[model samples]
Target: MSSAEKDKSPTKEVDTDELYQKTKDEIRPKLEYLRSVDDYCTSEAYEAISLIRETCKSLGRSKEKISKRVVDFMLEKGLAKLIVKILRSLVKRNDKSAYESRAKTHSVAKILQSNVKSREKKKVRIELVKCGIAYPLLQDLGACDPNTEDPRQRIRIITDLFSLRLLTEYDNPSVIPIYRSAKAVDILMKFAQVEYAIIQVRSLMLLATIVNEEESSRIVASGECILTFVEMLQKAIDSKDHHYLFDIKIDEENEKEFFMTGNRLTEGLNNLASNDANKSAIIQYGGVATLTSILRSQTSKGEKQEAIEALWKLSFVESNVEVILAHLNFDTAALEELKKMKSSDDSKLRDASTGLLHQLEMINIHDEPPEEKGSSDDQCHDPPPSYEETMSGMNVMISYNWDHQERAIQIRDKLKQKGFNVWMDVDKMRGNILKAMADGVEKADAILMCFSRKYKGSACCQAEANYAFKLRKPIIPVKVEQDYDADGWVGIVTGMDMYISAYSDAVMEKNWSQLFGELESIEKKD
Candidate 1:
């Protein structure tokens, strides 16, 4: 207490914590409601936030401290409209660039820039999203145009909110409404193309979440969102940037960035393609191949599952059957991965594997050894005769699906070698299919029906059979699949006629010989 000691008095630090604690007690009672961020926009949050802002200023706190306290109050009340309002106020008029000069910088920008490395800021961002800030933030992201004043600051605020949500509020339901909002998809899509990896991936992440639900899948599929999603996947796949989920090399250092973009983009594509409407567009855009590449990436198990599922949906289209089956070829690494999955301990993997295998087989892809080497001396190697022979009078019109065209072609070559003209449209179908079928049947002596499940399933093939029958052309039913219910058009045309069944080699040869004899009998009848 001496004059010398007093002269050397130490300045005491004002306890912001005690100040905050006491303020909380006093403020809580005086304030009517101290709940969500929305309270800031409400009549109740106004006085409390202003009080905290003033007290922090009066406490001789730094600008950063005042901002922190204001944020704390906003965060405590759920950081709702009041934060966005304050943030909007901080944005400089007509400035929208991240690299904008500091002279024009807004206080909100300063706070966000300061907190860019702040953990508390991170948590507050998430809390803000939980308080339903994502909706308005997303609206700004989508709604703002190049002409909007403070566009850059607005974008930063919107993106910052998303960055925080991605870090913390990943599973929140509030995200669904964000994309469902007007122009939200466009805004997200634009951001998704940003040069920055963080911005692009975070935008894609939000998109994936929005499309995760079946009902919202349509909204995500609207306009170029589907195409953009697919293009993102195509770029990732083209770059070969996915990390296999169960692989040994999944370390953070090597593939973290690429895998992040690839995984999120793939997830979004899968979710959007879950809607059947999107599948046709996807297949049209060659997205099936891109998706196959995703599976080939051997990315995460979840990502691969999503690709498999999207492919499964694409496979349902008969026109897409070839594309899907092509991806399962033996040379492609994806097939082996799928085959390995068939015996996996994971039930989902095993089931998806089994289903895909069955689907491929149904699409005419089968597991088999290399085709047996033909004998060196076989005279069947002899070529067919001149075109005059084919144009000569009677021919055998074989009705079949393109799936079994190889077999149909083999039989045509055999008939041609045997001096019988065989008119079979294997790969080419010119002009109107029905008209072509009618003309082909009209010029034929008899129609050799390559009857099977696929033949039954094809409308065009059935059309030929029906037309040939109506033309009074002798219908010869060749059963390719044993016990195949030939009970439809085949039964109607042949009328319980004895047919050649070729389910195996012995049966196939026997049927082939019988078919030739039947042709000879028909030749005699002619």
Candidate 2:
């Protein structure tokens, strides 16, 4: 073999299992000493921590399976808590040596960022949250000089920000009180405005989760927050490179995170739109035009959905509704897309589009001259403006136990694709399940009774089925489980009807065609 070819050849792989088993006993004593010691300032503590840090480095990245075993051992011995305490103590000191010891910050961040299984990482993050890790990380963010030219310092700050993002990703309620106590909203808002893409994205993500109420939303709306999101979204629309909104050279590996910037920005706007004043602010910022632009462009379905939802929320404000109508009139293609979405396969998209169109139409009629009041063939119109008038077509609600949610979702998607409005608890139903189910039943033109042994036994499913029967809604019996015969209450309600089987994907095509035929029959009867 050539020398270069030899260099490219694979080397002997390390047996991480054997290595971990061999060295864990030796590593335990050092960890125990560090965990018991309160002050990491002493020489003995420094020596032991240095050894552990080196050991972590030797374990390689958390992407390797064996490294996690070592991390788990260290965590079991309380090293994770020790590292946080060290960080807390270090944050109070402005000494050079204290700054040097920030290596522990990197170590802990690495441990949390481990590419171990997702569930395991989630569990580890929740456990570390209890260790009071957030406060110290926030302190690090507050202390770091954002504009420093030093690469190490930038990396250190990025590590701190990433750790904070992971902790807040799940939006645990416990973090809110702690964040409120630390005035985290203000801290995060400051970083959200930074020019650095990584820091800004993480900060915006953190802010989106914590800014959950009217008071917080109003607070953000009063600042440049709304405009910031508007500007980012506008940049994405203008450049047509939906992946990178910011003017940064992103590596291939990091491109996915930056690609979500549009979604995150729209989500931030959605959260803030809960407050009425914020809705007005969004309109004034030209957010309506930009969101409409998203619909006009070839953006992802998720981004489009978020944009539509945001516009729908803003539509409630009278002035904002006028602005939306004016913009849509000028952008005829976007208006067409909005109208087409009324028949979108996504239930939420269809619902939002119908509602937004209804608002625009009602406001237009109120503002029109009497001579122009009579509806023209080209102008949009709806039945007399009422709550139910906002929704159209035959709304089908899928009644099934949670055990058969997958099957129900498949049916829901198929019906939606066939131009039927579908309401399933997993998507359309939110808030109180009982109340939502009742509303679902009352509004539904037909109910798909998905049956299985477990589904027949479920109280919630029983309630949904019985309620639909009482409302005299047309029931389409569907067998969600293979070879399952419905008996008891289910059999009585769906007596002797043709059963549409949705037991598996292989049979879905035939099942959907049959179900569509049934829906067609109902439509004709109505």
Candidate 3:
């Protein structure tokens, strides 16, 4: 090779053999120092031992040989101080590699393995993986000869792992394998202590993700775990500790996924909610209180939104709403908090409050006395007005694009010609346009939303549409542009239908007349 080629070539490869020797030289004293401690086999102490063992393994040294060195080192260095120093250092670094190395230690796996049996090892494996431990090490731990003959010992190991904050990862699919095992399920159901708030919350979220609804239902119905999880969330919400909230940012992004799981859990719980005993149990366990607290807290906007949606789902059970309404009434702080939300600039907050108000209205309406059955004279009450008469008296609110003002004016003229009261911005008070539109919407018999591609992008229009939908008024969607599509707004109204009207002055003039005729037809039907 020429001089340039030589310069470009890599330097002599470091001998793997020499590197292994060098690593052992550096770690030997540290290992010796760690083993001298009295609680040397304790979880944290074992974690330090595991780290040294893993470092040796990474350097291609045999664990058996390193284990001998560690024993020798512990004999010489006073194990307790060495282990404490190592753990403290690793904790300070807060490095991912250190965590990984700590996870892979044979000592750690041995400690985990000794607590469980062969048949029930999967739970230990899951618990380890959740705790940010390496899955391969967990697998190796599972393959190890377990100390106990009793199968329940395995469940105890799993519970211990959970209590140790070992299973914390929410995105890992490896957990599914453990959840699928009956032994693992039993252990999860019976495990009395949860190590960390994150673990409990993640487990609840994970239970929501199980594809099998029956299995999911069983897990949620376990009583012990569900109640425990609810209590955990309640404590976190009440304490207002963000650390305990765990992955709040990520949860916000995957909220819909959580909701899908939560909805299933809710369905299972709703059956329980039907029973007065179960309902009280749920309330006493802090489910309703926790949910309300979350709504009132300084949580992520997404969490607040999800909590509202969850409350709505829970409200389907008749008893659930009564509980929520009671909370809303007596919890002055919570009531004030929600009332403050109504004035928020966020459209979502406004929409949620509107939905809640509508629900309250529905509940009240259901409690009202039924109308008298005899109505022959009531039916003939001055002979109900004809469709044209109704149209003439009814007010129609129009939401149209500013760029299409002339068309809106023309349409307003046509409606007025039919003797109908029309409230378009052109004819209404100029200041506080939104307030004026809201007032018109409240009083109008119907709202005519002029739909176009531009309409969807308008915040004002969306707010108005949301308000109209909340009011349960008939919204007649008139499509003026070919680009306009009604599919997006379909969820807002089932009675609302799309109508196409021409944009040209002459054609629009003709369509406006037809539009009134259609309105007259609807009025007659009503």
What C-alpha lDDT do the candidate models reach, one value each? Answer: 0.53, 0.66, 0.48
Compose the digit string of candidate 1's lDDT tens values, residues 374-468: 42122122222123255335677787766567677777787888778777765354222344455678778878888864455343454467667
lDDT score for residue 175 of model 3: 49
TM of each candidate vs. truth: 0.40, 0.53, 0.34
On a 0 to 1 TM-score scale, where does candidate 1 land against the true structure?
0.40
Candidate 1 Cα errors over 4 Å, as ranges: 1-93, 96-130, 146-171, 178-228, 238-260, 358-526
Clashes of each: 9, 0, 13
User: Which of candidates 2 and 3 is the stronger one according to lDDT?
Assistant: 2
CA shift of 516, model 2, Å? 42
lDDT of 3 by residue, 373-461 (tens): 33212222121112233346787777776655666777767777778877776532322234445666787787887765345433346
Residue 303, model 3, lDDT: 57
Residue 112 of model 2, lDDT score:
50
Which 10-residue window of candidate 1 scores lowest in summed lDDT? 376-385
Q: By TM-score, is 1 or 2 better?
A: 2
At residue 250, what lDDT does model 1 achieve?
Answer: 25
442-522: candidate 2 lDDT, tens digit per residue: 888888898875565344465578778878999999887664466545677788456888788887777677888898899
509: Cα error in model 2, Å:
48
